[model samples]
Target: MTTRTSHVDTFARDRLPPPQWQPEFLFELPELQFPDRLNCATELLDRWVAQGQGERLCLQAPGGVRWTYADLQDRANRIAHVLVREMGLVPGNRVLLRAPNNPMMAACWFAVMKAGGIAVATMPLLRAKELGQIIDKAQVSHALCDAALAAELQLAAAQHPVLREIRYFHEETPQGLEAAMARQSPSFDNVHTAADDICLIAFTSGTTGVPKGTMHFHRDVMAVCACWPRHVLKARADDVFIGSPPLAFTFGLGGLLLFPMSIGACSVLLDKASPPMLLEAIPRFGATVLFTAPTSYRAMAAQAGQLRIGAPRGGSLRKCVSAGEALPVATRALWKEHTGIEMIDGIGSTEMLHIFISADEAHARPGATGTVVPGYQACVLDDEGRPVPPGTLGRLAVKGPTGCRYLADERQRQYVQHGWNLTGDAYIVDEDGYFHYQSRTDDLIVSAGYNIAAVEVEDCLLQHPAVAECGVIGVPDEQRGQIVKAFVVLREGHVPSQAMVRELQDFAKRTVAPYKYPRAIEFREQLPRTETGKLQQFKLRSV
Candidate 1:
């Protein structure tokens, strides 16, 4: 376990422009402290909106539009009034928000929180079929959506009558916000909400099958902001959080919205954050901290010099965090190679609400996920629930303030054993106390009477220069029960050949246990990933 900080730059000969002076460094925030009484609704964000109402730069979109903390609170207050007085919505009702990363969407989210309604936010790209399932599961009645995407909801609503009325809010609305803003009062009273009151019902992108709605309390939302954003990133009032993850995903909700608001910091939301869009947005917004997945980091790093994106401008972006999937060691090294900053990788699940374990730059182990976050405890348990010893792999179980409580589903028993939420991941802890992720329990590959971790093989394949992205799984083999199968995406200019396949197969064999080598390989343009950048192994398993 090596943890040292130094500045090193790596760029190819064709990548550099002459030296344009090094950037200055900004002072970082103090170490984190957990709050005793945490609640996302009236306790955390609304309190900040009241105390820091006059702060000018609070929220901004990719278009350079800005809003003060007061502006956001005023709009959210007005929206809350519309929901209560006009729509006849009452406290504890479920109101669905379906929109892109727009200002109104942010306003609606906090407004829903302010009115003591549970907000169920769906991604903008969700189709009718997927949309209907969530609407049905959450029993959502009134949906707030961007006017541009409301027609899709209209079609979805026709299928599910539970979603009777769809409300539209857009920054571009011609009638203006006078009616919308005037509909609510800024002096609205805070509805008394218990800490256990359900504040959100977020659907997990079940890569395996139907999405599961993970119920979270208002306290859990703020609990995550206090534990994760505080301990790992230590976001300050001045830090500007930026990310490519969608707010629909808990990863984005915590990193982009809740975390920033908890600290009175600002956030930059990009409606469409592709590699190129992020390249332009990060520097243009003067983003101080970045939250994205490993895949995006790899893609961004590959083009860093060409796009001029990774360089710190105005000492912004002191921290870069990656989640949603294992951060490839090569990608982490490559990102540090380019930016002179370590890429912090963490594991989080919707059931837990946000990241429970992550590596801070100061405490990072390159290939290993960081130790369990404070206020959380983890154990590796065997099938019989006995704890496994160090250096041995087993199911990862965790117990903490934030735990899984499935929405109207009995499957909760299958995941939560005793007080520990059995995170579906398999991992091994070394004698040194560092934990290394092996693979998801369902993703473990068994071939030729041997157990193999798909992640170990994939991580090895990622080290190969020609391999850009890859997925490893166990495929049915007549002779060997199951065999390793690899789905690879090659680098832009590199073509896969028979020799290249053999070379990658050989590389895995040498880098890992012999049984873990991929006996079969297929080249593809891209590996399927969730909106949060989690690899869809189920999609690969189907093929």
Candidate 2:
């Protein structure tokens, strides 16, 4: 929670060009003050509760379930009491939350926050091995999981003695979660929390095998909601936010959780959000504004105009935002032709938490990520850390209030260079000051919004005696955006077979997370190498 002023040496001060371009939009921001100490559950929600605004809906789902602002506050209060009185949850404890997107998951998130504890939201599809790494890394003591996901949670809990309690919630059962919900009073009081209190621990993939926990203070939550939503989405009381990003991701947390509630707006939760699910939910929930990746838009556009996925029956849908990967120009054109609305693409990372460079409809460049947001400053720098000229590709560096602080990891230096958050992206700025994403310099394979490491996968593959050498790279994928493809040189006597490929995959599943396993494999006699004997990934990329 300690706020420090950042100095960006990556920017070329002496050769800096004049500010000839500026973003076009009426940014009439209200004066905002982030408190020195904060608790997102108790502080931000309490402020809205005291406003006594009745009949304003806070959340709704595709299934026709709805909760008003008053209803939301009451549910959060009761859940907080359940965590405290029944579960024996105390301050400073870490609670692992594994569930799909639903009203109950949202309620549980706030309850964890209200109890002065840090909530670790995990993607529901994660297996026991992945869950164990996060539980061990974050030192999570208690877990609240959906009954469906409880099997995996139980498997993970069996490995660690510190994980004392694993509770399951099933909304449909008569004696299930509703029983727990019925026991607590709706008018329970909020816990008093300091501003610097840790509220959430988001895990991001490291270069090594395990993921690192990025801790955020309650003030960081409020800071992100106030600054990012103000600059990007600008939610109003009447707007409905609909998105496909999992709530476990910081992107989804900002869009689905913090932004909407900060303004008393409504959010639509989608449990099974594939392209078809998105097509079904957008109109079913009457979503006014949508948030998702460019890949989703591409998949929906493939359905042509038959889905009628945008804006519903009326012109209620005013905006659409895309992140996670570059918005291909062809994909953007397809969505515009199908829906008659431009899909705004932005670039963000787990390091900075949410989008900092974005394009609004008013001043959008179809292929370019627009100018920097108000509270942040960005620059493109060459290898020596000097600013490059317009139209030149270089490492993008940014400085802002919400920059990353790793959880006891040494790789922090690679990301935080000379006080600026050095993003892995290779990018360029045009004469108009618009930013364009190129590729990742560190070769971090991003498949479906998940950061994966090549060396980690190679390490796992090397464990097999048959593999002499292996290299992993991301190949273009239609659904996932990119998937891991492995190039392997087998041992002199060993031949590559379906059995060998399956063996390598199963080996990776045991050593690392399942998602990191290579989806495609190729056999070779020898790997192309440099004079220094380093494997030339570029040559493998060509094949």
Please state every model's RMSD to the true fold in angstroms: 15.4, 6.8
User: Can you list the residue pairs that collide in candidate 2?
Assistant: 37-195, 37-196, 38-195
* Candidate 1 weakest lDDT stretch, 10 residues: 5-14
User: Per-residue lDDT for 234 in model 1?
Assistant: 78
**Tens digits of lDDT, candidate 2, 1-543:** 144211121111111112221111121345345554456775556666677774688888866789887777777788777777777777767889989888888888998888777789998767787789888877788887888778777888999767887667874665455577788888765555665466777887665556877766676677677676787666677889988888998888888878888887889988878888877777777777788888788888756356665563244566788888788888888887877787777887776778889877777887798888777788999998899999999999887656666656566667776667788889999998899988888878888767787877888799888889998888988777789999999988888899988988887776666778999999887888999999898898898
Per-candidate TM-scores read 0.75, 0.87
Off by over 4 Å in 2: 1-32, 171-178, 302-304, 312-316, 459-469, 477-480, 489-515, 526-536
Error of 2 at 27 (Å): 16
Displacement of residue 500 (Cα, Å) in model 1 is 27
Any idea what lDDT model 2 has?
Answer: 0.76
**Model 1 C-alpha lDDT per residue in residues 114-185, reported as the tens digit of each score:** 777878998776667667878887778778888777766887899999776567876355343445676557
lDDT values, one for every candidate: 0.73, 0.76
The list of candidate 1 runs beyond 4 A from truth reads 1-39, 171-178, 306-315, 443-543
